[model samples]
Target: MSSSLLRRLSVGLAALTGLLGTSLIGIRAADAVTVPILVADVDSGKVIYAQAPTDPWYPASITKLMTTYVALDLVRQGKVSLDSMITISAAAAAEPPSKMGFKPGTQLTLDNALKIIMVKSANDIAYAIGENLGGSIDTFAAMMNETAVRIGMRDSHWYNPNGLPDPRQWTSARDMAVLARALIRDFPDSHDLFSISAIQFGRAVMPNHNGLLGRYPGTDGMKTGFICSGGFNVVATATRNGRRIVTIVMGQPSPRERDVKTADLFDYAFGQSAGWTSPTLEALPASALPAPPDMRPFVCGGKKPPAIEDGPGALSAPGSAAQLIGGSAANSPALALAAFSNPALRARSLPPRAPLQPIAVWIGRNPAEGQQILESQEAEQKAAAANTRAAKLEAAKAKRLAALEAAKQAREARAERAQAAREAAKEAAKTTAKPAPKLAAKAGRPLPHAASAYTAVETPSMPEAKPGKGLSKPAAKATAHKPAPAKAAPAKESTGKSAAKKPAAKKAAAEE
Candidate 1:
């Protein structure tokens, strides 16, 4: 690398290292020395000079920069016009200090509210502004966190509508510097609200808290802050010869020390060379801060509002711009009505203990008829349930009857099979019991014992077989033999003749 280029690179690195190390210094005493300071290049948005810039300290009133940013956005969208009236609630009037003493039921336009907020540092007005824009103080704090995320303000959190002494409500000087840059870029036309030195609201004179407006050369406006914990802190911005710079000093003993430290920053920034060596800080360039897309319908007082005249710094309500800018419609819906619930709705007009019925939905002429209708519906539902149970019971009874009948039929078939087997066994036993005759063994004389076995063995009469191709018919007597008279009669009658007739025929044939 060339010698000149290397020299430039080294200088840039040093500048970046110094900027990174800048932090707020914690003061042990209210009158401590070695106060904090930081000077940044506005065009490039880089810190040219810094001392104790990153130190942890309280923000006090300088926290209003973010408040102003949020309010200015509402103005740009026309949801809040400059002359629009804001009614003061009793709660808003109850805030502690740095306030506008508007009586209950008193009204002030948004135009004057911004002035009071900037100059007098009114706490109640800040809360009211937040409540108007964000519905309530708690919800407004959430919006603050969301805004911080969107703007890439990485290290800031908010807890209240006004910057009170919650540990959660702290921010860094560098973070404030980034906010100042955003205020100029985001709300350029409305940005002038920050530079106002004095504003008159009903004979009360309010002067701005920032000390740089008239004292420093080319210094217009920004903001300042103080707290017992933070000591004194200021975020000041100035322009000279078309170059602007923002300086932040936190944790000074007195207000006077904070201003002096900030002036030193300006001197060092103006003296520094134009070119930067650090790629991170050098890359930052001035561009239009993104306008919050608005999707709310333009309307006022129960009528379609007239088309708003577009200003040079025309801001689309969150929805309308998003549609044109390829932004997500799902994020911010089109609000045809008011964005928030009316605070007046929460305001009670009646006393706490009034005779009221919570259960009744609406009052009507015939209350008794309505009650009867409800009773009838209830009765119908009960009847339907009862009918369902009865039907189920009937179905179960039919199923049980079918099972019982099937079991009875099965038992009858088993009994018939058992009786048939028993009859066959009895017939086989009678045939086996008959003694077999033995042939005469003694040539001409039959042995008594052997003859007895062989003597005319009356073979047990076997049941007659049916006349089929393979089986011989049983003896004629076997056919006539009956186990019982009633059992044989049916067979004999079907065979062709009665037993008595057969016997008489046989006797007649013998006489012939």
Candidate 2:
């Protein structure tokens, strides 16, 4: 063969080799990732790509999508309004975080609550919404299951409104894609709720966890979920050139992986020729759906799968690899043909993420009414706080009064004791100050006398005539009587001496 012919043959062989290698890589990549994934056309209900689509897996917070559907259905039926209030119950408030953390009896309008549920993935709000719409969580779950069956979700079950961990709660990627399609079809008016990137309430701003909403070009709305047993999952939708696609990726190793995989799927689906078709979602066989896999061992048990990326010379997509090969060889004809023919094979530049404009929803109230209610709630809270403060102050005042009264009684008691002590001392001193009893002198010897029994008397003096009368016969007696006068005079002198001694004795007793 001529040299030119040989060159052409070599080029053809290289292209073939590159194509085969790329196909093998894709197959290997698909098998290496055990996670369930599905991409479908929203308009025709045709599935573009599928891997274990019917396999059972934990739903996690994605269960809120169903909860939202049921709620929106109730709204359609006129059973509830967007502005209707949903009173948070203890059960709802008690749900785990990724929650609103509102207390029981805290009220939020359904409109605003739905925004929180979509953006925050608030478990508590989801439960509260279920209760509000269905009268109880159990009833709401029943409603969810009923709707799921009606919508042709054969491999799904719901045990709670929020997608919290529950062994009985599970769903398949195919089912989620079905639900996503139905949501767009059945509730086009409320479809924008899923597209919200963030919501604001007062100072708190909750951003949606659906990374694809902004990172992936053409992405509009959907949901994301994660739990140890469920791994990371997402149901994403995008619109490009008037054509829309829905993709579900479950059991991803990380949020980044899920987002990249979803973006790649969108690029692949959108780039396909109009004539390309696959099995309709409804016509897909469901013979041997796999049992739900427990991802806890791989996700939470610290055993992680190896990272997989398309090799150089392989097709690339947005948010993933740029080119299969690097350096000068990247411009090879075979690679260029593959990348140009297949959008997924080419690198893409996504635009900067647009600022999120969340739809505003409030409890059974318009914006004005909601504002009024908020102000009223604030006023009530302030009033309750003021009342509590007043009560505390009253109690403190009463305590102080009681203490003062107790102190006054103690002082009175102490004063009474002191007064009693003073009286006792005075009585003791009076007894101590009294005089002692006196003794009498008799015949030059001291004698003790009983004062109560003794009395003193005076004797009349005998005259000197008694001595003259004793000189005659009778006078002789008279003279004898004169001697009696001498005796009487001595008695008088003794009486005078006794009177002087009495004063001296009394003075000595007083001194004692």
Candidate 3:
């Protein structure tokens, strides 16, 4: 009786287990998030582990990798030296935060700009780098795309230098690995540029955004990026013994998660046999997705997915450790997932970072020179302002003087006109006065012929003439009108005898 019942129970349990397993697989397939990951050997370019590596995704601030690349390339071309000064323009300054907040016209060497971007991930500085290097953001972006193609990045299109949000700008995990490898192989001297612990710009000290920089062993340098649309992203590099590896992680929900996930992958990658047969970054085929899937909904949506015991790539990479160890489908895409990810290890906090080694970056060629140039510029501006003010004052003063001069001239003219009028009026009063005959009558006497002489010389219809001092001839004429008791009367009385009688009278008077 016990055997029959036990067999029946066993059969029932087997059917139920198969059904549940199938349902779980379907749920995973439908609900799993798309996280593009890639791990590659720095020198060989052989991909040790990759997951959706070729699927397009937003690069976020990680776009600065291309920016730094373009700038360094220009330096390599000998077009611009590291010491060449670049300016923070208005457009660059206008960019939103994660910035240096330097004012427009602030000047700094390209070297400083590169350092600030790597450590601070400053959007403004990155934009300035693009503008300065490429003559504009668009041209720099063109350079980025060109270089992407040249570097064998098959799935990337860059529209901006700083990986700010733009639908047109996207890169695949495989492409990012290709870029990272290019940056390393192309410019070995710039190794410190990516892994700087912190940058001291004036008084402010900005730490690098890459959490793994100091927390993880053998971590050297690289980059990290994020936007709501593109979750926390990173292109990281680490060197152990003599080998370096590049790991690209995209679409993590938070900084903690990104760091944890990346650390997990690094562990899994380092554990795998380095010589195992694997696809190269270029060998990984591209995803057929037409567009980059937007991560904002899942990342920034009001409700985050509930935390589970396993982290990213946990479910997808099942039992592949045993398979990979035996070299079954080793070249095929499989999870680099650790054989078992203990909850303690996955959730463990990273160790405290080492003391920051901050590099001093300054404006212009040197701090002193930059200060001097700024001072000189400021002085020149002040002088110009003073000159402008002086010019305005001079113009106003000239205008006031001109008005006064005009007023003075007008007053002088008026005075002259008034004096002339007064003179004319006095003359007119004399001319229009009562005739001289009335003056004689008023004097109780008559001046013989005076009225006729005065009337003959002056007329009411004529403008009066001044009593000029040099009018002696006209005065004599006036006096000539005085009657001499009739000279002709005396002549008639004495008759012809006057001449002889007058002579005799004069001789007799002389004798007496």
> What tens-digit string does per-residue lDDT give for candidate 3 at 1-512?
58956665565454334212222332323223346778888899888777668877878788888888888998999999999989999999988767877789988999999998888888898899889888988888889999889879888999988777777788999988888888888998998899899988666787888899889999997888877566678899888767788888886656766776677666656655457478777678767666676655445545543331112211111111111111112211122121112233345567888888889887778988867766786798899999999999999999999999999999999999999999999999989998454222233345355333332221112224478633335544444344423212232344444443556545533543
Mind giving the per-residue lDDT tens digits that candidate 2 earns over 336-400? 22322333323333446678775554433566675776788789999999999999999999999
Over the stretch 225-280, how does candidate 1's per-residue lDDT look in tens digits? 65444445678888877888888876443455456446655655655654656322
Question: Rank by TM-score, descending?
Answer: 3, 2, 1
Clashes of each: 19, 27, 0
lDDT of every model, 2 decimals: 0.55, 0.68, 0.70
TM-score of every prediction relative to native: 0.48, 0.60, 0.61
Candidate 3 regions exceeding 4 Å error are 1-27, 31-33, 303-346, 371-512
lDDT: which candidate is best? Answer: 3
Off by over 4 Å in 1: 1-36, 52-56, 278-512
Least accurate 10 contiguous residues by lDDT in model 3: 316-325
Best-fitting candidate, scored by TM-score: 3
178: Cα error in model 2, Å = 0.9
